[model samples]
Each structure stands twice: as C-alpha cells, then as structure tokens.
Target: MSRRRSARPAPRPLRPAAERIVDKRDGQWFVRPITGATSVKTYTCPGCHAPITPATPHMVVWPVEKALLSADAIDERRHWHSACWTRRH
Candidate 1:
C-alpha cells in the first residue's frame, strides 16, 4: 500500500521583535511584539539592518514573537531575524 502525506499550511513565522516580560526557569511568561509604541529594548544586527528575532518552537508560536537575550546567553552571539532564521528552501 502507498501512503500519502497530508498538506498542512506552513506555520506563520515569528515576529521581528519580542521581549521577556516574564522570565523563569521554565521559560518566558509573556513575550510581546517590539514596536515603536513601547520602549522595546532591541539590538541591531551588524550585517542586515533587519531586527533580530528569537529562536523558538516553530509549533508553539503562530505569528510568534522574537526572543531577545544577552549576547552571552546563546551558544552563538549571532542574533537571527524571523525571516532570516525562518528562511525556507
């Protein structure tokens, strides 16, 4: 018998900016968008001027928020933009 794969819509990508309004050992309590309305702390990428987004579960986030952290926190200091990181083949 042959099996067929179902076509599910690709998930919405993460937001360009998000903040850890709440931090815990488990994870962020609440992370909202980084917009001009609020004083969202952000770092500009040296390479692309595009805002950097966080690396998060592709599933947990639908129209997700970018995770920002101290440069020392992540394995690589290189921050990623939602579009840049979520680039599909």
Candidate 2:
C-alpha cells in the first residue's frame, strides 16, 4: 500500500532577535518602522509640540512602569518625530 502524502507545508521558524520592545532605565519603549501596509494615525509630539502627520515615519514611546494601570500607560503612549526623539538624549 502507498503512503498518503502530506498536503501542508512546514511551518517557518521564528527569529531570535525580532523583538521590538526596548527596556531602558526610564521605561520600556516599543520601536517599529512605519510600513506602507499600516494605516496612519495623527499624533502630537511631546518634544516639539507639533502634530505628527499620517503616513510619516516616526517613533511610538510609552513608560513601562507607572503608578497607574497598564491600560492608562498604553493610552498615554506618544508618537514622536524621529529627530525629536533622538535629540532627547
């Protein structure tokens, strides 16, 4: 008797260094590139007090540790201009 063949392909492996969240002395920051596939959203930059236009590449940052709840922290996340964020150092 002939053996039945598998129809599905093998699953791909996950990358070890694919994490986007970074832990610093202040808090945890999520870093990611704005891709064309993503829908854009407008945000005000805390550094420059200017609006971050949609479809523009930028950075999203939030504090990891806070007295408030996790939901509050997520809501408080800010989108910043790439240059503005870099100058914060």
Candidate 3:
C-alpha cells in the first residue's frame, strides 16, 4: 500500500527583532537582541572572542555610520553575548 503525504504549511520565518541605538564611549551603535528561538546560526562574539552557539540568546550590533551607508550592513554586524556586550568598554 502506498502512503500519501499530508499537506502542511511551512513555518513562517521569524520577524526581525526591534533595534535600539546605543551610545558607547567609542561611538554610537545599532543594536538588536536575538532571542533563543530565533537564534539559528553559530557566531563568534568579538567581545569575549567565543562562539555563540545556536539557540543561545545574544545581541547583534554594528556601527551606526556603517549601517547607514553600507549596502552590506548585515554582513558588518557582529553577534555578541548579551553580558559581554554590556560589559564592553
């Protein structure tokens, strides 16, 4: 007997998190929080120089100026551990 496949709609992609501007001693930045549910890819945290594994909550940050004029702003963004980003001077 042949089995029939059931029809199911694909899961919708998560909407991007709301971004906030941060003022640091170095410069202004555009920051967004990444929730565990939406965190899929592994990334390196520049602050701690460690790997941010999938499903781990983190922060995505980039220079405001770079983000404003760059077409590849997403590529310039870095994923950082929440605590590390907070403690960074």
Top lDDT hit: 3
Question: Please, what is the whole-model Cα lDDT of each candidate in the order they appear?
Answer: 0.39, 0.68, 0.90
Measured against the true structure, the TM-scores of the candidates, in listed sequence, are 0.23, 0.57, 0.77
lDDT tens per residue, model 3, 7-83: 98789897879999999998888999999998899999999899999999999998877555578656688899999
Better of 1 and 2 by TM-score: 2
Candidate 1's residue-wise lDDT over 1-89, tens digit each? 99978699779885566543444344433333333343334555434566543433211112123346533333233433434433422
Query: Global CA lDDT of candidate 3, please?
Result: 0.90
Error of 3 at 69 (Å): 11
RMSD of each: 15.9, 5.5, 4.4
**What TM-score number comes out for model 3?**
0.77
Q: Which digits, one per residue and each the tens of the lDDT, describe model 2 over residues 1-89?
A: 99988898888884433227776566677655454234277778898999888877777776655436555656666777878877775
| Clash count, one per candidate | 1, 0, 0
Candidate 2, which ten residues in sequence have the lowest lDDT sum?
30-39
- What residue runs in model 1 are displaced by over 4 Å at the alpha carbon? 1-39, 52-75
Model 1 lDDT, full chain set: 0.39
Clashing pairs in 3: none
